[model samples]
Target: MSNINPFDKCPVYETINLIFTKVKEEDAIDLFECYSDPITKSRMNNDNCGGVWDTHNIDAVTKGIKGWVQEYNDRFYIRWSINHKQINKIVGTIEIAPVPNTTRFWDGACQTGILRIDIISSLENKIVLSEILRMVSDNFYVDLDIKNIIIKATKDDGERVLALENNSFDKLENSTFPYSDYYIK
Candidate 1:
């Protein structure tokens, strides 16, 4: 299943005024910084993980991005770093992965989108989140694609969930993967 090709050209997500680019080694510090906030990290990693503050694992983060890039190059996975142009910082990440074509019954299960966008917990940033979602939805397009998208967030991530819904995401009840959707799961 590692043969899909993402568009070589960078896609412009105007609402957020950022370009979706492959996650790179250089992104380690920015990502760590964004994930450093206890609230932000907990919200994204279910509070069970997220030691980015004290345990600033730059090597691990860089290696993770390298692996992601390698997987993208092989078409096994796709990961993008969300650059917040307004602040000139890397705000968060998004990804898509092809279901492995293995003997598992769910082989060819479907492509899935995984997104984790960081935003200030203010009312104004809620609008920013919505705009970001709009840009993401409009700019994302590729083959082996799935009709549904998923997102993952903790219970405290209500604002993000709301923003995603406002932009066209439906939550799946009794689901258990960060958030219930094809894009963020």
Candidate 2:
């Protein structure tokens, strides 16, 4: 495998209906729609991350996007804006980062990617999630040099749970995380 860092030049992932690319300042308006929506925030997995997805204004959204870019530069994580093809707008963001030792969630020999996906509640269905999950499953392992992918989905999130299951993600029954149930692929 190549030793180059994927964060050096964020790779864009595309599906038939959506595109995932590094979050940019220009995405503030569209992202604000998602960030400010209570429904979207309800489905987001903040977990150990200190930041909250809910925002009150575009300024906060803009600042958040800048922080995400800086985080990418620091190799802390890669946050991608999920753009819908038909709508021609950013529907949400997907954050993929290495499982930190602080979490103590995975004891596996190979590294694992912790995925946090937050999309507009209207599009937060099995079909849309399955497509996004498929893209992650197909590329994130080799791109991030990880053997597994893990995500959090609450029991109430029936669509997300079903999508994860359809994409070959099994629930981690003994997960120590209290925020929600975790699934591994």
Check candidate 2 and list the clashing pairs.
Answer: none
TM of each candidate vs. truth: 0.69, 0.91
Lowest-sum lDDT 10-residue window in model 2:
101-110
Q: On residues 90-176, what C-alpha lDDT tens digit does candidate 2 reach at each position?
A: 999998877763432122343777898989999999999999999998888777777778899888999999999999999987665
Q: Compared with the true structure, what per-residue lDDT tens digits does model 1 show for residues 1-185? A: 21432533333344536666778889889877655555665554322223443425777667767776877665555567877677787777666544232211113465554454654333225576777677666655343345445555444566776776677776657755443433342
Q: How accurate is candidate 2 locally (lDDT)?
A: 0.84
